[model samples]
Target: MSRLTVNKTYKLYIGGKFPRTESGRYYELKGKKGNLLANVSHGSRKDFRNAVVAARKSFRGWWEANAYLRGQILYRIAEILEGRAEQFEDELRAQGSTPAAARKEVLKAIDLFVHYAGWSDKFQALFSSVNPVASPHFNFSVPEPTGVVAAVAPERSGLLGLSSVIAPIIVGGNSGVVLASQSRPLCSVTLAEVINSSDLPGGVVNILTGMRDELLPHLSSHMDVNALLLCSDDPAEQKLVQGEAVENVKRVRLHPDAPLDESPYHILDFQEIKTTWHPVGV
Candidate 1:
């Protein structure tokens, strides 16, 4: 008798656990050759709303965590990812990346995490400034986490693009809810597993897999989400996000068809500047 293979059912990573979509709807994920790969939960607006609530609940803890500790936690995520390197590479290959491309993306994702980990403790100093005041007071500005961020992960490169968008946002202590690539979402789910095993707290980063059109409107318009990071090429979608963001005056960062790069500016995108004044003679 031959043993039958059992396929895995992918679910949404919300709060801390993996739960099937509330709608109980799933979409078939097929490989490049049109073979069934897996059944991915087709996340709904309700799911995105749930994710935002989770992110909001956890924001203060993650935001107040010591900068060095945040860096350590991010580094731990990189360690966990490094251990699962082979698994990620395999998933990327299954998603249609050539073997070399898969390996490259996996390595790049790991390195990107480490890069942000290194920046976690350093960004504040680099971005902060002291202002000369005439009122006999010391005035200075510092960057603070913008609470909750909703990001649309790049649709092209599964692992690398997702990592690029996420690592920087959380490195500065902002918790995030990300919409994974609809066509290639395996790495995002796997990354959620890696995050779960790592020291990063639950709700610090929530991963949802589904259609962008289905999720974007809800994510962009949600009042609880403090910022939006979009990685897309669609002008219509970009316009829609900008228009909806007006409801909350949300900070919107649009990367229209742009390749991901290593920069501290990405971290700044989700940060709010706060200035403090101290009486000099008090």
Candidate 2:
């Protein structure tokens, strides 16, 4: 009898090619059974910038998309994700999740997708408000897409946390540069495939795996980035990212370092600012 061998390395998702990391830095990933899954490429600043350019190019069309259309696309993504729940669970298990926990995470992830999917149409109503400031002309406020955002997925609940942060921003019509969870990034890369297959235009959400300390600073301070979401629980680093966010006044979210459970209204936390302009005169 002959023994069979299989290749199991992952690729860097850039320019639509799953090429190996440009910097050639690779890291070992342990699986649910404590077995080595494969080596994941560690993205660098150059790679991050490349992803940013892709996002910026894709932003105009995505942002200009009608709210209902965007909602439909996002909802479609949720539908696809639900249909492919097993695939995500398999990836999660490869990242070291038990079957029960993987199922729970997949369900939450679907809910997270649907949650943000709904917001694609509703966030505008929730965040956009009419102001009666007794002004000379019809004055009101509206929330606009904040252009490109940079995100860091929570280190722990790697898959679900990444989805929670990324979905809201993109559904709201903003493009993003996301740093995948360093320890367990397989799910993030797989998510890129999900978005690619969905109605979402290219670059709506770009995922990169790399050292947080190395890549986050550039993302935070990058003048092109309009906002950021720090999903990690490290107060020191969180504070630093927030501080850098101030330079660009990037919107920031500091998620709690809690158990891998659903947080209430988590999607709302990152939705777009929608302000409606209307006349105060009756």
lDDT for model 2 comes to 0.76
lDDT of 2 at 65: 95
Candidate 1, residues 1-282, lDDT tens digits: the string is 899987777899999889888988999999988998889999999999899889999999999999999999889989999999999999999999999989988888888889999999999999999999889899999999998999999998788888898899899999999999998999989999999988788899999999889889998999999999999999999999999999999999999544479899999998999999998884
Candidate 2 runs further than 4 Å off: 1-8, 15-17, 32-34, 258-282
- What is the Å distance of residue 214 in model 2 from its true position? 1.6
Best by TM-score: 1
Which residue pairs show collisions in model 2? Answer: 32-96, 127-274, 128-274, 128-275, 129-275, 141-275, 142-275, 143-273, 143-275
Cα lDDT tens digits, model 2, 1-282, are: 897987656766664456677788988887756787878888889988888888899989988999888878877777888888898898888777898999998888888777666667776666666566656556656667778888887888767888877777777778888888888788877777777788678777788998889998898888788777777667889888888889867777776643224432444455455555555576
CA RMSD, predictions in order = 1.1, 2.9
User: Poorest 10 consecutive residues of model 1 by lDDT?
Assistant: 254-263
